[model samples]
Target chain A: MPLFFDLLGVFFFAVSGSLLAARRGFDIVGSFLLAGMTGFGGGIVRDLILGVVPTAFVNPFYFIPPAIATLLVYFVAPGVQRLVRPLLIFDAAGLALFCTSGTIKALEAGMNPFSATLLGVTSAVGGGLIRDVIANKTPSIFDPHDIYAVPAMMGSGLIAMLWMLGIRGWTWELGVTAVVFALRILSLKLDWRVPKAVGPWHHDTQLR
Target chain B: MPLFFDLLGVFFFAVSGSLLAARRGFDIVGSFLLAGMTGFGGGIVRDLILGVVPTAFVNPFYFIPPAIATLLVYFVAPGVQRLVRPLLIFDAAGLALFCTSGTIKALEAGMNPFSATLLGVTSAVGGGLIRDVIANKTPSIFDPHDIYAVPAMMGSGLIAMLWMLGIRGWTWELGVTAVVFALRILSLKLDWRVPKAVGPWHHDTQLR
Candidate 1:
């Protein structure tokens, strides 16, 4: 069941990546590469930090999501763009699943709650961060216009706290995932944003 | 001896990262974070791909280089700018050492020659790529201004071939490192660049 959600998250993330690639006019190879990165990069980063082989590396099934995403975008990208912000919805779904799954994995690996939370959040955000960076865009995490990382942090933190309190049921995990998904979608719909740094130096633009 | 070279490479990479942060007017915390990423990010990526705990993650000594780099940049950044392209020099040295060291490590882990070579190039370039992405700059690997990954590729491929031919000595490793370092420096000095796409559609900038 966990693996099912994990692959679902990978598919969603890969779709978002392929959509971005289509918008950017990348070639087919580039689209597949970007989708693969977006689908598997986070788990790779998280597993690396946890001193384990990323599951995607050893499992052939993991490649299916990115391949499917690339093919889907190759055919229906123009029409896909007309959906209800398909990119953001997919990204949010990916984020929600990854944060919950990552937190569970970290806990099972014997990581402390705080470290687990941090790692879970990293797992949720790392892929999109890499995608944006490679595409030569400012990373969404650092962008002041949206509340991106906050929901992941909240979801991961809640999971960690639940684990510490011995609540390890799948029901709880699903509940947290729903909470994160709702928060992300609501934030996007409401144009909610985190405040930028405050103080005298906030307006300083001397440096590039 | 390998550990010494690895730390030296870490130091050089951290210095380059810190210099960039200093120039960019990042806060002290940002400078240290960037320096740490530039110092340890490559090896972490390599080790993660190899499915092992990163040396920097386990050893306390790895933190020293980034700390020293942050302090140096915090104090002498203005004076340091007068030197002969300090950033490029440090970056080239890091690239050389990482490519050699990463290739050696991958080979020791029983990876095939091609995979080892590719991992080595990834190790050499990963840190700088991360740093540039976080800094909102076009990653040097993708920039058309100069050849960056080529030197790493040459060094790593040579190292892998040398190991396959039973010439796995420190002397050969150093020789390859020197070759890569010189190639990178010369590429920068001569303004050498790889060719961009040759198609008439290359001028298409319709995508963001």
Candidate 2:
């Protein structure tokens, strides 16, 4: 069941990646590669840091799912764009699943709570960061208005705390995921933003 | 002296990355991030794989060089583009240096010859791969016409073999670097490319 959610999350993220590539007018190969990276890059970085071989590289299923999702996005993008909001909701669901899973995996690998939570945030946000960087945009995480990384950090920290307190159950994971998803959605709806001060005179023209 | 060369290489690569970002009209923050990644991403990956903390993140000097380089490019891209070929030569020199340095670092960290060679190749070419991905271009190494990765592999392998044979000197390192640099230059001059296979089916206007 956990693996099922994992695959679902990977598929959705792949779709999101493909959509972004398409929006940027990337070719088919670019679309597939971008989607593949979005689905696997974060996990690869986390695994490498932990000295574990990346699961996506070894598992044929993991590879195939991203490719399939990329193809689906390529063919269905015209129709899919009409329902962008719903697709974003799915993306949020995938983000929640991935953040929770990453926290669990890091803990299982014996990382400390802080590092585990950091890994979870990285897992949730890394792909989008890559995508934005590739597309030459400032990453949404660094944007004041985006609540992306914060939600992941909060949920993962919550999960680590609960796990340390011996609260181990599907219900617990689901609760944490729900809190993250809700926080993210609420932030988006309420236009929540990080505080910022005005730039110095010379830098003011470039501040975004 | 070695630190000087490292800083020079970081500056050149960071400028290249910034120019690429500017050509695509990225904002100042985007330009800085891309430049930083191009300058430091490979070394960070190599260190992490060898179970060492990323030196670029720890050292303020490493961060500052790239930032300065990005500022230079941000104000001088048009002039920089005219020197693309010369800049590439500098980049190749840096690649050779990093390949040797990375292999030695891996060996010092107790990695075997094969792992050391792999790390060296990755350390040399990894930044460029990340740069290409972010710039939305096919990775130059993956292009059959580009001899980028092959040269790195040869340089790394030679260093590993020579070290195993107890041949440790500036002479061996310089020789290997020259060989890699010469091969890259020759490949460019000769328009050398890997052979391509024929199409599975020849089609003309999709005759039905």
Candidate 3:
């Protein structure tokens, strides 16, 4: 069941990545590569940090699904755009699932809870960060409009807390996942944002 | 003197990256970002892997050099192309220096010789890898024509062996750097290639 969710999450993230690449007018090869990275890049970083070879590199299936998703997007982009809302929902679900799974993996690897939470947040948001960097845009995490990282942190933290309470099962995981998704959706709908303070020290000075 | 060399390296790499981005018809912002990544991306990755915050984020000088280099390239791309060879020579020097520095850092972090060597090689070539990925090209390391990683490994291995022999100071370091630069230049001049067996697996099946 977990594997099934993982594959689904991979597919949606690949779709989102391919769409972004297409917006940049990338060729088919670029689209496929970007999609693959979006789906697995964060996990690869996490694994490398843990001193383990990336799971995406070890499992051929992880590669194949993203490739297929990219191809599908290439052939069906016109139709896919019409289903943007549905795809966004799927992406949100995938984000929640990946965050939960990442936290669990870090914990199982004997990392401290704080480190595991950080890993989980990174795993959930790392792909989008790469995509934004490649596309030459300010990452969404840095943008005031998006409540991206907070939800992932909440979800991962909830999982860690629940696991510590001896409630280690799908029910607990799913509940945490649902909470993250709900918070993200609600934030989007309510336009929740971190308060901006325009103090004397904070000016529009370009550092680079 | 070391800081001067490092800045010189940043300038040439930024020029190379910006020129590549211009050739691809990227906008000015894209060119700048590419140049910045090419200049400092490897060091950032090396730091992150060693469980340290990236120095690039903390140092304004690191950001400034790449920004200036990118702006120069943006305004003078046609003239810059004529200096590609010199820029590459500087880049080679940078690669050697970074490889030695990375190995030392890994050793300081108490990593084993193998891990240090691996970190060294990655640090030397990592920026280029990220550059190629963003530019939508297969990484030059994976290219049959490129002898990129081998020189880095040779330089890193030499440094590690010297360190093991209780040799410290600029003498051994400079010697290893010269060897790496010479080997890279020789490989380019002689078109040195690792031999590949002509077999069924080597055949190109796809008709591009």
Candidate 4:
């Protein structure tokens, strides 16, 4: 069922979060927090925008994967580095599932198409942003060499397009997810990058 | 009157965010984004956890002050460093207002006191966290020299306690706010810091 796929996506993202935490040298609290944020942060952001209690708090099922991931990272992180290939693949899959579903949810909540697409991208990438920020690094999306956000935007845009075309179904969702997954995986393997912006100003940055 | 105070808080927070952005060398977009985040991010986080559309989007009033603050930062940032003394005052006032109101909102939404207090603290500090994260710095609250989160926590805890005592009024709220504001300002002036944990592990570095 869809719930199963959702949980699977959460599981992979949690592993990625925890693994990243281990690599960064954060203690156990940091690992657990990162896993939760990676698995649920995007959805929580989306839900908050839409005026809903985050599902992560409402359903205990969402906690399981992240908890397991933290334990895995603590126990076997050294060996996990060799599994980068699998990790990247799972990350892509999670991106696909999350981006598509995130767009759908936003649209269903009556958001405008453009904002919905942006929110979808947020739902896909926001968790990683939180993780990177907490680790005191520049967000990967803002990195000139990073291709992470582009494919997520592309997939989210496609979902918005599908909705505009008056077509909505699991079949369409599955097809879009596959395309996003492929694109992400391909981009990773080929070391593709978004054309960098040469902003005319220094990076020193902001306000309320 | 409360709305006026709310806008005043937003304005001050926006200025703080913009000042920080300028110090970090972020461009105009970063200034605007940080302003918005610092002014509205905490409340949005609180609303999301409480299941409400953020008031910022519901009413145009919330957006005005941050926009103005961004403009001010763009126009007169160089001279504003001299304003740091006053800036801390406004920042403390904003923190007091936000912490008290955030706690009240959570209690009204029926969350348990512990969670409500945590949420209130979050609403008080979340914006600065966003700003620091984007600027690629460790959040000040996590720093041993920081007194920010602790004071917010204390204020939030007091609000929760007042609810438990069946004493909820504007008078009580103002008293709590005054106490928190004084504590923050005093800590800043005195260079007070939270004692840090001597953790058993080294800080290695990555999760992915």
Best by TM-score: 1
What TM-score fits each model?
0.60, 0.56, 0.55, 0.58
Residue-level lDDT for A36 in candidate 2: 82
Give one digit per residue, the lDDT tens place, for model 1 in B1-208: 9999999999999998988887778988898999999989999888878877899989999989999999998887677455338987898999999999999998898777876876788789888888887887666665555678788988999999989999988999999999999999998889886533212233343444
Model 4 misplaced regions, further than 4 Å: A1-41, A48-96, A103-119, A130-138, A142-208, B1-41, B44-93, B109-119, B130-138, B142-147, B150-167, B170-199, B202-208
Q: In model 1, where do residues sit more than 4 Å from their true spots?
A: A1-39, A49-51, A55-126, A133-208, B26-33, B48-51, B67-84, B195-199, B204-207
DockQ of model 3 vs. true complex: 0.04
> What are the per-residue Cα lDDT tens digits for candidate 3 across A1-208?
7666666667767776766655554545556656766787677687777877555644446756677866766555444334445445655766787888888888889998889998988887787677666655567667777587789989998887777776788877878888888887787778888765465466666534
Q: Which of candidates 2 and 3 reaches a greater TM-score?
A: 2
Which of 2 and 4 is ahead in TM-score? 4
How much lDDT does each candidate structure score? 0.83, 0.72, 0.71, 0.75
Each model's fraction of native contacts: 0.20, 0.05, 0.00, 0.21
Q: Which structure is stronger by TM-score: 3 or 4? A: 4
Candidate 3: stretches off by over 4 Å: A79-87, A197-208, B1-78, B81-126, B132-208
Error of 4 at A48 (Å): 5.7
Return the clash pairs for model 2, or none. Answer: none
lDDT of 1 at A191: 88
lDDT of 4 by residue, A1-208 (tens): 6677677778878877776665555545556556777788778887877777776655657768887887776665455345456545656777888898889989999998999999999888877777667767567667655477788899999999989999999899889988888888787778887543544463343211
CAPRI band of model 3?
A: incorrect
True-structure lDDT of candidate 1? 0.83
**Which prediction has the highest lDDT against the true structure?**
1
